[model samples]
Target: MTEFLGSVWWMIVSLGLLVTIHEFGHYWVARRCGIKVLRFSVGFGKPLWSRRDRHGTEFAIAAIPLGGYVKMLDEREVEVHPHERGQAFNHKTVWQRIAVVAAGPLANLLLCMLLLWAMFVIGKQDYSATVGRATGMAQAAGLQGGERIVSVDGRSVATVGEASMALTAAAMDRHDVTLQVVDAQERQHQRVLPLSQLPAGFDERRVAPLAGINWQFWLQPALVDRLVDDSAVRGVLQPGDLIVAVDGERIDAADQVYPAVQALGKRGGPGMIDLLRGGERLALEVTPRQGLDGNRQPVWQLGIGFSESHAPAYDTVLKYGAFAAVPVAIGETGRMAADSLGMMRRIVTGSASLQNVSGPVTIARVANVSAQRGLDWFLQFLALLSLSLCIINLLPIPVLDGGHLLYYLIELVKGSPLSERAMAAGQFVGLALLAGLMGLAFYNDILGLVTR
Candidate 1:
């Protein structure tokens, strides 16, 4: 119950701020365009807090906090005095009207830049591209421990997070992807992973596993964080022991340690384990025990968990001076927007899964997760989400800013506004299309939960 309520609260906060910023854009632009705004509302339904501005705009926070609006004086909606007619939104020139309509999404995009700049200044510590071990795909691709993965699908990635993002994108679009890697001897080569071999209806967690990649930056001396009671080897190994090697192979990263153990375990039972405790090197004879995965496949397993703890020598926090953060933020935002748009285009063209469409449930979960991570992470999440929202709003669909701009465009070409009946018909169609989109997103969310 607490978890559910936390998600709801996070959703409300996230949506409320974004909606206010979006609506304020319209309100600000409308006023500047000489349009009289009847109301500048931060939410819908009954007014929770209301005030009238000196300029006669009613400002309010309404009961529902999911969305908001800038209610402008339109001749079609209200009778205007002859002298006041000039201040009506309908009296604005076509270009002026288009600008007013476009401002909402534009504001979101701008907000993303600012948020990212703040986040960059605050900084974050992420893992680099060194692996401790390899299994499944990594092993099959002959990726030994300690190899540095340079790129995914030809796109350079400096961090493990970047590689994961690139690989995730590739996984959704095709049956295979190429990873450019540098081995221990500093030799460069490409490894091709066939994600297509996975079962149909592939979900989020399955992608990397099926593609044979589990990455870890920290080397083999991983201190045990926890051992699940259900794990067969839980009591065989105690926490805080530094695992330096598995069997005869020297293990630096956890990635290198895994394949060596799993393969040996398949031969029957545990293998020789070499570990360091209290600065003393020791050897313990052990074997990998037979275990079942989620699919009930019998596999050799080690019941060990690793938590985020820097090995002083391996990782560093990245902080940017305020002066340096702005350009970095702009560059990152631009790249993110471009990548997102490209992915959307692929989805539209049926090259990607429609299951990617997520509803409020997924967003709420993401919001909760990000908020839990840290302020910098939450801010970055907000920036990415706001940018995506900006693009989504700019899509040319009725009842949206993009739809209004489309009408303004037609007005420019025709020398008059669209006929009322035609505008009404467009709005009707737009609402239907929006309903369908919502339905699809909700269905996808529910389907994901059920499958899990």
Candidate 2:
């Protein structure tokens, strides 16, 4: 029950805050354009909290926190007083109307930039970009594990995050990506990853395991199979965990784990092992059980089995000053926005899975996990969610801010507003599209719950 409530709380806070940011963008822009703002709401449904400001705008916090709206006085929706006729939203120039509608999404993007700036200024862990192994196309390209990648497609990639962006962009663009790497023996090689033959729906992440490319370089080749019931690591470690770091030392290969484990157990009251499951990294402390060895000497062990495949982990931390962070954040936001748009385009073109759509349940789950990870991670998560919200709202579908802009564009080009009946039809079609999207999102969330 506590866990459930925490998830719900995070979801509400995250979604509510994001929606408020979006609505405020519209409200601020509308007011600046001299429109009579009737209401500024932070949610939908019944108003839980309401207050009319001195400016005549009714500020509200509504029951449903999933979305919000800005209600501007429009002659079509309400009878306008003679004195207020000039301030009616419908009376505004088409360009002004377009700006008002577009502001909400633009606000979201701006918010993402700010959030990212904060993240970069504060910093989160950082790691060098190194290859773990190769699968599928990577193997065909002669890429090997343990190589430190120097660059991708002429872009210097000092970190896995940077490498990932370049790789994904190249793969999605259907272009061969050139990788300059120094192999384990310090021998330099150039590998051309043929992206033309890359699977349609495979994103950078999904391509990793199959392509034997571990950009994060945190995966250990030996997979943890299980723990004995009475073992020291029984509860601390789980099956399928990939050992990341043993004690305080990072392991670059499976063979390196033995020396670290032995050194830690020799003088340690407790042995620390950092592990990765899915995308989450965890640290566990265990006291190895001592037993007689072949020479009748005592040997300490953590009762676990290993498998052939590797377990992966990732960590990064790059900090900058306020001024320095701004450009980096903007660049990061642009790349993420491009990635989000590309993913959407892929889905629309039937080149991507609709199952990628995430809804409330998925958001709640991620929010909870990220919150548990601490503030830096949670803030980063929020930024990404904000970016996604911005992108989705900007999609040219009716009933959305983008839809209003689309209508306004037509009005500007045609020199007249669309007929009321035609506008109503557009709204209905927009609602239908949104409903279908929501239904699909919910279905995907439920399916994820069942499968995960």
lDDT by residue for model 2 over 339-425, one digit each (tens)?
Answer: 788788867886556877889999998999889877777878899999998888877888887788888888888989999999899
What's the true lDDT of residue 287 in model 2? Answer: 76
Over 77-107, each residue of candidate 1 has an lDDT whose tens digit, in order, gives 9989999999998888888888889899999
Stretches off by above 4 angstroms in model 2 are 1-3, 135-140, 155-176, 182-188, 195-205, 215-315
Cα RMSD of predicted structure 1: 4.3
Error of 2 at 232 (Å): 18
TM-score of each: 0.84, 0.76
Top lDDT prediction, candidate number: 2
